[model samples]
Target: MEQLRVTNQDREHVVEHVKAAYAEGRFDELEFEDRLERAMTARTHGDLMPIMSELYGPRGVPMPRPVPPRATPARMHTGPTESPERLAASAAHGLAAIGFPIVGPLIFLLTGGKTSPYIRQHALEALNFHLTVIGASILLPITVVGVVLLPVIWVAAFVLSIAGAVSALTEGSFRYPMTLRLVK
Candidate 1:
């Protein structure tokens, strides 16, 4: 396999995650500094994997998603988009508001995921986002400040869901910002 290079931005991203884990009390001062150094100097995505695994579980570190080869950009938009696929994709995002984040995305994932790339991508994005939210909800309560961010996260999730639903309605493939691609 080709080596996956990490850029300064990637290292910075990992640094932020390490800082959050520290704020959540996942690491002590010494360990936090050590992790921060490692994240800052990481040369490749693989170098950051163990650092994330230390915060989350082994499965939490997401591998790079392989883009499917397509003959043309038109391949992405040429499929049937107005019927069950569009509605299902929209529902995948909207269901997070009703508390079926994991289930709702999985439903469409199992139903149309194989036949519809659009639905599959949305379901995967929603699934990863909810997983991150749930993980944050659990960790943030450990600190007084994290407790405050929890409600803010809740509102962001709701508003983002509505936005994703709108994008789905417009037949656009939408991805949530700052989302860990764990399911991809």
Candidate 2:
């Protein structure tokens, strides 16, 4: 089979994947920088395949292979006070409804996100959702129909923020609907 050429978008996709992998503690800083450089420089599918092979297995594989355990410095708590961490994560979502919007989640992300992946995930979700809401609030006012729906959007954002908080508290997983995910 002939090797397919890779475009800038393809390179960006791979770079993003590499970044996510690094964020998840799949590799160390040096390895991440190396992989990032390789992904950015890739010119063809063949070049990209090997970059992710260790993380996702072969190119045609349907699922990722298991990752062996590694000593990651990011994990801070193991037992006892874990519930407080969950509360903090839940608060990241709840703060959006109370008018903080961007600042609330950004605070949580900067404070605890660097230490705990769970907190980071929840904070980032909340941050992204609020950003999407803010963007909509700014752009939607230009159209008459949007002006009518503006209040509706605000209400939905409020209700959804509460729901997101509840989900983060109970399930540790909550994805806000209609989010832009601009941060990551």
Best-fitting candidate, scored by TM-score = 2
Clashes of 1: 0
- After superposition, the stretches of candidate 1 with alpha carbons farther than 4 Å from their true spots are 1-74, 78-80
How good is model 1 by TM-score?
Answer: 0.58
Pairs that collide in candidate 1 are none
* lDDT (C-alpha, whole model) for all candidates: 0.82, 0.84
Q: Pick the candidate with the highest lDDT.
A: 2
Models 1 onward score TM values of 0.58, 0.60
Worst 10 residues of 1 by lDDT: 61-70
Instruction: Tell me the tens digit of each residue's lDDT in model 2 across 66-149.
Output: 476665544443222478778888899888889999999999999999887778888999999999999999999999999999
lDDT (Cα) of model 1: 0.82
